[model samples]
Target: MTSEVMIQSKFTKRFSKALMSLTLLSSLFSSTVHAHFQEIIPSSDIVESAEQRSLTLDLTFTHPMELGPVMDMAQPKVLDVITPEGRASLLGNLSLSSQSGEAKRYQASYQIKKPGDHIFYIEPAPYWEPSEGVMIVHHTKVVVDALNGKANWDALVGAPVEIEPLTRPYGLWTGNLFQGIVKKHGKPVPFAEVEVEWRNDGSVTVPFESYITQVFKADANGVFSYVMPKAGWWGFAALVEADEKMKNPEGNLVPVEEGGLIWVRTRDMK
Candidate 1:
């Protein structure tokens, strides 16, 4: 072949290979960069008499549905419980703890003093993610109903971002519709995006990346709904970019991703 033609052919081959590499790299990154959820999982969702009122809560930063590569969590900025009467700080009771293959998790125990729905919430300290070049802070919460109390299950705890449940946060059955309004700074965010996932307990397996989490968009009123497909704990995270920025570990200002998360449990009807 002519020199010019040979050179052109080689150039084309090199360019094609480079483009293929870029495409594969993009696909691999997209599959792994999933939604991180702040889990405020309790030992039990329902507290009966004072004997059963005490519950232990574990705070972990990770992908609950996938349950791997647990993100290191710093001490939370705020942790509190809101009852029918008022809100009280529970941070003093939190103790730094870790689990197998994970570090920097937290645990707390609280005793129910009255018949009311107790909402446990935490605003985790910002975590720097070098992969995304941003810091993430999730305002995560869960509810424990005491003696069938319905009060305070729907109360807002003034989180920077939060999911205000429209459906009763407890006593849900599988296939029941779960609805909540995505609020940021006490205002509705139109067309907010939410990620939903079920906490896996080693009985289930996901064959594809898409099966790890489900995404939905809120309506004009900042309300979204989903039906739980299984009998387990489900978490809904409404993510939004904060107006403020925080410095990352690299000492550079980066965008903050504020995730408003809430967890609820569903049981199958016999």
Candidate 2:
């Protein structure tokens, strides 16, 4: 062939090869992306027996974005529990701890009252769709049995309620006493008392009379605050008095009314 003819033929072959390679790479990447999005983790197979009393489920998710990019939209995954018979049992709403680092882990606890085979499904994405584009959905399932006895049940069902510290932004560190008030249902009743307790060496003591510096009334807002001389794990509870109509003829509050517990901790004071 002539020199120009040979050169044109070689250019055509090179272009064809490049096009074929691009097609193959596109097909392979599309298949891989589909598989990754459709993947589901393993499910639990523990059967429910009489011995099993409670069930606990822990879930974690990782996003491809950085912390600063999705900080506002970052939230905990939602967990939905459906009984074996196809009834919604427990729905937990959780959020990621502000203290969590880059991995972004959120946690929540659920208490199973009845014994049965339960199926849990979690969605690790936002509930509402954005106007811009649709977000990827990650879902998984698990089964649980509640035959593990009361202690095990409580371990899964009951957790220590987290209490946040109450402190001013900047304050002097002085050995001083503080007073707190408690109210319920927007009214202040006389019998509404608050008790402060603490624990040391696994022994709990009700030191309200000694350590409690003062007492105040819960205003119309039903709010209170107290300052502790020392820092430790402290518990507080309030006595919610019954309504006036429920009182007896002798002006004594009824006994059937429920009480309220107000628990908080002071991590630091400035």
Candidate 3:
């Protein structure tokens, strides 16, 4: 080969290696930095009339701010609704409803029979995150009030790791403050890290990566608080390393991220 052609071939090889390195770095940074939320969003937070008794909840595991890049979610180990009366399993109500090329999602249709707070919670199966090398299990919950029945909104679904809301968690103004206690096995977890994100509805623009997810730490008593400034569904996830490691898909032991998440919505007071 000519000397000029040899030089061009070497340059192209070097450029390709450099580009591959950049791509790998970018993927690693995104996987580790971006927040993952297990969402359980109800059709309505407050049910008033007869027509609104039927509620639909969309369940997915994804980056809430980015609104996409969803992860495949296996059927949850537990799915139930806790009310003033009692707790009832809703796993049979779940149906596969995933979009093309996206992760497996679930949609549940629930009929409100009584007047009270309906607390729906889920314990999703462990998702193996290859980028972070950890298994993620988020126990998520959302509350929907039926016919002005607001009792027992703070009821617990008895998760291994959970966020016990100090606030009512529903029917609030945009500027209202939300407080919750991070709990593990019904006990408080001091200084637990909590990540918060706003579910983008294709209207807001994220100016920077930092703006995508907001984070905070629980106090000495495992209590954290934040004020909602936007009128949409906000998800708060309290995350901590699990006491026990789980086997990965490769049959190797890996750390587990036990997260307790809760969802609430606010309005602009129109």
lDDT of each: 0.90, 0.37, 0.93
**What are the runs in model 2 whose C-alpha is more than 4 Å off?**
1-52, 62-73, 76-78, 84-86, 89-98, 126-134, 145-270
Instruction: Give the Cα-based TM-score of candidate 3 against the true structure.
Output: 0.98
Task: Superpose all Cα atoms of candidate 2 onto the true structure and report the RMSD in Å to 1 decimal.
Answer: 27.1
How high is the lDDT of residue 265 in model 3? Answer: 94
Total clashes, candidate 2? 9
Cα lDDT of model 1 by residue, 1-270, tens digit: 999999999999999999999998896686446878899999989887778978899998988888765888889999999998889998999997796676689999898888889999999999887768789999999998898765778889899999999998888999999999999999999999999999998889899988998998999999999999999999999999999999998789999999999999999999
- Candidate 3 residues lying further than 4 Å off, grouped into runs, are none
Tens-digit lDDT string for candidate 3 (229-252): 999999999999999999999999
lDDT of 2 by residue, 35-144 (tens): 11111122223434534334444344321111011223244344566553444523444445335455444444455566554445554443222221223333333334
Pairs in steric clash, model 2? 51-147, 51-148, 52-146, 52-147, 52-148, 53-146, 53-147, 53-148, 171-270
Candidate order by lDDT, decreasing, is 3, 1, 2
Model 1's TM-score against the true structure: 0.88
